[model samples]
Target chain A: MTAKATAPTPAPSHRGDAEWLSMRERGTVLGIRAAYWLAIAVGRSAMRPLVALVAMWYALFDRKVVRASRAWLLRVHGRPAGFWQVYRHLRTFAQVTLDKVYLLTDHTRALRFTRTGHELLAAQFASGQGAILLGAHLGSYEAMRAGGETTDLPIEILGYFANSRMINSLLARLSPRAAAKVIHLGDDPIGVMTRVQDSLAAGRFIATMGDRTGLTDRIVRAPFFGQEASFPAGPFLLASVLRCPVYLVLGLYRAPDCYDLHCERFAERIELPRQDRAARLQQWVRRYAERVEHHARSAPDNWFNFFDFWAAPPAAPPSPPPP
Target chain B: MSQTDATLEDQLKRLIVDTLALEDVAPESIDTNAPLFGEGLGLDSIDALEIALAIHARFGVRTVANDEKNREYYHSIKSLADFVRARQGEAQASAAPA
Candidate 1:
């Protein structure tokens, strides 16, 4: 007999009302998988609407998610940009999010644009050089997956996986070629780092999140976008341990289907100096900030860090209790 | 099912409370008749799998997914305890060789 499909029981009062929402999330996950198979089996047109719907939903929603997102933008940026500025960035973020689906489904030449920063990636990977590909939450930065597809290079990503195994299995089956290359170390901190170190030792590329904290407190404080916030130390520490060249590889979504795969040489060969490791990390952190800063300043909304950011003082103690 | 075994029941309740990270839940508050995953302790699919794994490793009792009776037995701590008791008794009976 097949394993019983036991779904999570959401909170009670809204149990009857919430079934639709729970189904929606499941649908969203399935849609993503279906889009993948559609891309491979039925080809490109099958995925166009899937990508479009993702972008439109984020762009059109004004109150619930968008309103909260706008508040998040204010808190992170310290001030609001013009209407067009916010809209442009949100549109870019949405488009890039969709762009990932399109990239996964389509072939290489199906991509429209120059391979702008690929040489930088190769140069960093040459010899015993293994660097962290520090990426922002902005754009559909799945270009690295595409890169592994195009080149014989072994690129492994240290990232979060969906909670659903069904989805994971489908994704692996969908893109068997690139799926083997992508190393998604979801919750295992020690194991994740070990895999990164192992992959690098084998002269393979390991890419992880430049921003965001893991479940526990694997976060470190840093100043970004003009405020004190934390970015995961996994990227920097992994770079230090492996002693590899580090590049900030980002794929910016320019339009509906098209994207600009930009790879800039942020830093090559960073030294921990044997004594002051934190200082060495700060130097690399500054370089990561500079690289992201370059793009974020140009396309402010394209920086899709959904949670609160730089506005808060680093580890500013929790606010006083309300009377 | 009414064993009047308060200590053993409390120990199991504590395990449920701690393992699942049931934030607002109290051990005494969890009703024996209420569902542990859904209506009672409020756990999810991943948590259910985790709890199932925890039960197998801790108790040395491997739960059979194929068993139709597991639907009623896996529903609550009391039900689960009874199933375990029955299984253990069967083991003892077989070991004694008639």
Candidate 2:
């Protein structure tokens, strides 16, 4: 047999595609706007079939999403993923996205939440100091926000929202109060830092994603799912600078209507001294990756990063070696 | 500028240079009025955090997180010196007896 015939099919090269930031937000504004209004008008029970239809459309037509989903599923399951599995993955994402409408609108009476390690957060609040809640893209952060509202805990989301302008704008319209809670990462560095600091100092938790690396963010490589992937060092660096406690919080979707909000302390404080800064950063990132892996393995379908997460990062000039 | 303010600015310039590890850029080379971020020294977010930490550790004067004036205060070396001096004055006043 020819060498080519004997070889496994090479995965399509996504190197040409810029990072997730550059990926177009997929659906048309009008379509998403229409969907949002429809969900609000008809309510979730009536919207389930339509959501499934839309998810099915994406699962069938979006080749990139399908490939990414299959890749993640294979790693999680240790077997080839079936077409139905991919469809269900897309459907789950669609359901969660749709739920954001109700969550943002304070219509969370229909949804259920089970919280664990809440006492840890309570103890942190008892200290009269703010802490950082590091979350991932695995599940519904909105659910956690809703839970916080009921308990009178203020949470500010620090995120880069340039990519999802349409969705963000629509969601903001859903609840101006909820919109105010978002601290968009933008041009004003001092403003962003000060806002985060102020919130933390006031004993309000600041929630941010630990996974996605921004365009100019410093990143560290960590072994994830038996492969090396880049995780942003920004969160950890910010934690060290702010001199605040860091906690891992994930709001996992347990299908149908329940969200399990899990919170655990990641660090009392992240200290990266000048003597061993890189190594310390690497250790924190590795532990972060391990925690993310542990959770992702348990809730395999909750993984929402619909991109080639393991693809080689864009090259950058190497830093000068440590003295 | 007052002699103390000038000295404070110079001290801040050295702190920025050393804290960020600007290899070729000398402390004195940093202009007092030149912006510290975005097009001036060409620093990013991480650099800002480093400078914040260094200032906190070295001067023991913490930058107030919610102060609306932080943007202006961090604009340049001169402004940072002003901020530090003002905060120092406030701390001293708060400590003094009525």
Candidate 3:
């Protein structure tokens, strides 16, 4: 056989494309979302069949792409779910579009819930010292609206919201609930971080993702699920740099309108004791990775990292040493 | 400065080992003239940037973007040695008790 070439994978030249999957050319998805929001605005159940028909058509005619996509998810991620199961998940992805539109239109009713973690949240809020709520994409985290409404402190979600301007504007209009507490940390991160710090200083309760890599330069490599992955050191770095406490909290979906509010101590206070800020930040990343792995492993079906976690080549044999 | 240069390769090896936490890498085994980007060490762009930052903090060397000097400087232990020698010369000249 001819010798194979070792070249870097063909990727977008922009560093931001390396950051994460781009939403720029996602006009089809945007169009679907726009149609949903328009239906919601018309205040008629008239478009109900139209929306279901679109979902049905995708499930029926989009067989090739969905099969390949499902196969990849199964092959790469051990998704034991069958073709129909994967189709259901994709079908529900459209349902989430409805959620986004509903959130913008009727934020309170959509995000409304009965609180359970009262004493725990209250003490955290009462402390006047900000706490980090480590949440993942398990449940309708918008239920956090009820969480904030119950507590004395402001429960602000520090997340990288949708980049699509049209979708975001729709989300703001369609879901008044999400618009109230949702703060978008778009491309310019340090500026958004200044706001996060200000919120924390005001003794507000903060919730941010501890799973995926963040939008900043700071990163820490750690082992996750028997493979190496890079975790964002920004949150931990901020905790260390800002001398704050970090809590591991997750809102996992149980059923319709019900969720399990899980909480555990990842690392309480990450203030730099004697070492440099970077070292302390590394410590926080280590704990965060362990917690993320533990939680994801606990619910592998719920592990949401669809992209390659390790980013290593598939089926490559270890080569012999170079001369 | 030769004393520092004597241990320079060892320092760089230590830097990579420490920054990446690679299980199999040893300082003495890293080829002096091997390519760090591709076949030699099999390092990626992220690793290059990661090791670059750590090396800068430790050795006072700044890695510029899209720079060709890196290909030459990162060629082998000998190339890094020569570059460090020039930097050390400048540092010494600037610090000659002026």
Candidate 4:
């Protein structure tokens, strides 16, 4: 007799009640995957019409995503967002997703990147010290990876991989270099952290996104664009324990087959004394939010949170009366 | 507990509390057999790494590449302090004007 399959236990989440958090693998659309292969067989220029068609279809049909897009655009642009503007935002997202196939599948000819702040990364590498490259959904992290591939530094990415294992394995089969570097974060936090420590010890760059909260950790709430949002406390805590420099890395898509890879030093080192752990966590989280807001203003279409980022924050626990 | 082991445990507890910046955790309150990971101390992988670093800095012990053995060594404060003491003894013996 077949034993009943046990249901998987959901990891505790410290994120806001944003609808996107419930969705699995936003980039796993079958049509998009098929088009990616077609773009590979033909050129990205030939695939443009298809990408635009797909983007337009989503803009017209997916009301929730379009509405979210409009809300984010209005918030960033400081003005009423028009339908055409929202459509452009969706189109940019679709274009970036399409470019991922080229970036990850080893089709490098399609991308032309202008890099800044790379000297900071080079200096960190030269010092024989590991660093945390905190990134966001605002741009192509794949481009950042591609740009850094030329350097001898081994780059490892920390991301959720349970739902995308099949797709990840398939893609990894196509690009072994990218596959070897991923340290899956969800299954076991202890395992992930130990592997991260190993990578840092071996002088590898540990890259993770700071904008999205992990599903299994406590969040540090901070103000984003004048509204409260929750950010994961893990990376910042990891930075403190590791006592290493932290840098912000973004790879904004500039044009068809072109991107501007930007990197900026975020912190010399994260220090969390026992007396100031709470306040320090909040301070660093707020600083990260400010940087994300600044970048989102410049590339209005690149903010990929696609959820109600300004939702009401959870209530803080009451403090005990002073003695 | 012997005076030496008690002192080692106290030193390890202080090292852990300071290195991890743990809140609400006093060194004297840490149990000798309490696990270093997960539910016991609520410490994650980064804490394990920091503990490893602290052990190296204070006792000149390095974590091996074998993850299973490392986990055994890091199972509890008692296990970790024992590993450090043994390693220190070995180092001292090897360097004793041979």
Native contact fraction, candidates in order: 0.00, 0.27, 0.02, 0.16
User: What is the Å distance of residue A204 in model 3 from its true position?
Assistant: 2.1
Per-residue lDDT of model 1, residues A1-323, tens digit only: 00001223432333221332334335435555544444556545554554445545554653343554576567556776545545555556544544455565446455665467787767655765566677876565676557443444556665554434555565566566554344544443333444565566667777666865543223566667666666666666556545667777777655545556677766666666545766777777776776777776655556665434553323532432221
lDDT of 4: 0.73
| Native-to-model Cα distance after best TM-score fit, residue A253 in candidate 2, in Å | 0.9
Residues A137-256 of candidate 2: C-alpha lDDT, one tens digit per residue: 888777776756335567777876543455556656876665336666764676678678778988989888999877667879999999999898889988987889999998888888
Could you say which candidate leads in lDDT? 2
lDDT for A296 in candidate 1 is: 67
Model 4 ranges off by over 4 Å: A1-36, A147-153, A163-172, A177-180, A255-257, A313-323, B1-11, B21-23, B33-40, B59-98
lDDT by residue (A1-323, candidate 4, tens digit) is: 00000112332454543324434243343433555567789977777886677678767887767878888887777888887887788778778877877777768776788888888888887787778999998978877767454434567778765554555565566567653366667555544666777777666789888987655555788988878888888889888877778999998886556888889999998988778788999999999999988887778887777767666545543332221
- Looking at model 1, the pairs that clash are A130-A244
Model 4 C-alpha RMSD vs. true structure (Å) is 6.1
Candidate 3, superposed: residue stretches over 4 Å from native: A1-81, A100-118, A147-155, A159-191, A272-283, A297-301, A312-323, B1-98
Candidate 1 lDDT by residue in tens digits, B1-98: 24356654565676677665555668877776667644455443334444554555555555553344655666787886676667767767888996
Residue-level error in angstroms, candidate 3, position A36: 6.0
- Which 10 consecutive positions of candidate 1 chain A have the poorest summed lDDT? A1-10
- CA lDDT of each candidate? 0.56, 0.76, 0.54, 0.73
TM-score of chain B of 4: 0.87
For candidate 3 chain A, the 10 contiguous residues with the lowest summed lDDT are: A1-10
Candidate 2 stretches greater than 4 Å from native: A1-19, A22-36, A148-151, A163-173, A176-180, A317-323, B1-6, B21-42, B53-98
